[model samples]
Target: MARQVQFDQLGGPEVLTVREVEIAPPASGEVLIRVEAIGVNRAEVMFREGSYFLQPAFPSTLGYEAAGTVEALGEGVTHLAAGDPVGVVPAFSMNDYGTYGDHVVVPASAVVPRPPGITAVTAAAVWMAYITAYGALIDEGGLKPGDHVLVTAAAGGVGLAAIQTARRIGAVAVATTRSPDKKQALLDAGAAHVVVTDEEDLPTRVREITSGEGVRLAFDPIAGPGVDTLAEAIAAGGKLLVYGALDPRPTPLPNAALYPDLSTSMFTMFRVTAAPERLRRAVAFVNAGLSDGSLAPVVDRTFDLDDVAEAHRYMESNAQTGKIVMTVSHAPDAS
Candidate 1:
């Protein structure tokens, strides 16, 4: 029997349950992975809380990103072999086939080889975060060289990835944080400038920094009333990517603040992973960056599996410095 986190109800982290389950061998085009490291995202939280676009049936598995070694390959799966290290982007649905488990079965197409030089934890964290950022920054927003970017909730998983993407895309990254303590953490994570949103006038300061030209893009994950800050800071014809509403309140928009309308688009990793071509492109892009040493996933902390509840609580408390990963079988020997 394999163990996994499943939720029978929609609510807080307490709704998540680790239970033993039976799984059949992989079918054609599928592979079974012995999951190692799992990346926790805001989407999983949203899914858990029943606030996401996808409604949950009782007793559904909960997770989206993970890295592991292939345990078994199903018929017609020729591209991979057992024992191959792989990264999973499990955005297909909220069903039993998720990354937060001891073993998971997925289509071969949903699995990408973990980059050669990257660790399992980092590779697990990379798939969803990097792809989400790429789809929004490159494909949707058309982020270009010399464009300035402002990111809200800039210290979280996808938030950190957005900052790295901005750097690679030749954009100036100005990241925001509600936590006064994470100010330095943001700078260390490749942000060109850090704005502690709760402490400063975000729009005014952003305008001052860009000399009134404003940022070309604002990547907002925490879409609450705070979105107004980013909306006001965008340059004319800029894009505002609203990916997540971590805050419970509806996002604010200062309607009359800008002359030309600020271009805004809804972004989600689920959407990024919806089509096969998009998934392929994202895997190629992130893998290439990994191969060349240009991209890296930041894992702030790792916890043992039984401590999963603690990890969830820590995440909700917002004290993490970077990605908070959960290690199942193979954690680095701390000694």
Candidate 2:
């Protein structure tokens, strides 16, 4: 049996519970993994609250990212063997599979071999953030060298990943945070300039940073009433790629009459995963960044499997600057 997190009714962090579940053998095309570290994401929180893109069935398991060792493989699976280190990417639906457990059965296609020199914790942290940023900023937004890009809510895992990705592509990254506490951290993480939304005007700072011309692209996850401010910061003919609905309010588009060249679209990792060739390229790019120390997965804190509820509460508080990971402790085998 393995310990896993599940919620019968969706509401708040209190709804999640850890329980012992039977570890079933993987079926065909599935791989059984002994989870080492689980990466907590905002998506999971949204799903738990019954507001995510995918609705939850009663008693649903919740997770999308983890790093672990292959314990068993199903029929027709030959590429990976038992004991191989791997990372779980956000390539599958949480309704079908969940990584918040001591053991998980996931489609083999969703697993990637862990890059060398990266710890299990770091491997669990990188896939979702890097892939989401890569898909939005580079694959869909067409970010280019010398272009300026604005990243909103730029202190979370995905936001920091966007900053690093922009720097990796030789683009100027203008990051925004609600407070000044994370200003230096964002700068250290490759942001060309930092804007405190609570103190400075977002559009005015962006214009000054870009020397009167607005940013060429804006990557935003906080889509709500604040989106209009982001829209005002975009250059004419620029695009706003929004991938998350962190805000509960409706996202309004720029007035067509005033900014005819402004374009806006939604981005999700699902679109990138739909294309096999594009997914391969994204993986290669992230691997290269990890190898060269250009992309670093910052781990904010770790909790044991038993303290998952507290972990969820902490995540909901939004105090973490980077990834919140849960470490699993396995029982000793009695041979």
Candidate 3:
């Protein structure tokens, strides 16, 4: 038996519980992994609260990123073998698969060889944040060098990833956060300028930073009344990629007459994996960034698997500047 996290009902972090579960052999095209670390994301929290795009079934597991070693392989799987280190990508639906467990079975296609020189904790943290940013900024936004890109909520995992991605592409990354304490951290994370939203005007700061021209692109996860603010900060013909709703309020549509040339698009990782070729390109890009040290996983803290609920509580507190991870204690037989 292996320990796994599950929730009987949709609710707060307290709804999650860890229980021992029997491990089953992988079926065709599946790989059984002895999970080493799990990456906690905002998406899981939203799913638990019954506010996410993916609906949760009662007695359901919740997670999308993890790293582990291959303990067993199923029929027709030849790319990996026992003891191979791998990271689980957030390319599948959470309702169909989950990574918050001592062992998990996932499609072989969703597993990528863990990048070298990083711990399992770092590997678990990389895929969801980096891949999501790659899809939104590079694949969807068509970001180019010297362009100014505004990243809202620039202290979370995906926000930091967007900042790094923009810098790697030679674009100016302007980061925003409500807290002044995170200003230096955002700057250290590759943000060209950090805007304290609570103290400064977003659109005005952006306009001044770009020398009266607004940002060429805006990557925002916070949607709501803030949509208008983002719309105002964008340049003519600029694109705004909305990937998440951190605000619980309904997203208000941008004023078309105010900025007719501004295009607003919703982005999700699903768009990156919708095409096999596109998925391949994204993976290659992330791997290259990791190798060159341009892309690094920022881990705020780690908890044992048993303390996952506490990890979730910490995540909800909005005090984290990077990824929160849960480490699984390996069994005696686990490699």
* lDDT, candidate 1, 237-296, per-residue tens: 888889877777966554655535777767877666878887788788889888886778
Q: What is the lDDT of candidate 3?
A: 0.91
- Clash counts for all predictions: 1, 0, 0
Model 2 error, position 213 (Å): 1.1
For each candidate in the order shown, give its overall lDDT on alpha carbons: 0.82, 0.91, 0.91
Query: Which regions in candidate 1 have their CA more than 4 angstroms from the true location?
Result: 252-258, 330-335
Cα error, candidate 3, residue 106 (Å): 0.7
Candidate 3's TM-score reads 0.97
- Tens digit of lDDT per residue, candidate 3, span 1-335? 77899999988888999999887899999999999999999999999999898799878998999999999999999999999989988878888889999999998888888767778998988888998898999888899999999999999999999999999999999999999999999999999999999999999999999998999999999888789989999999999999888887989779887889988988988777666788888888888888899999799999999998899999999999999999999757566
lDDT of residue 149 for candidate 3? 94
Candidate 3: deviation at residue 99, Å? 0.2
RMSD of each: 3.1, 1.1, 1.4
Off by over 4 Å in 3: none
lDDT of 1 at 197: 75
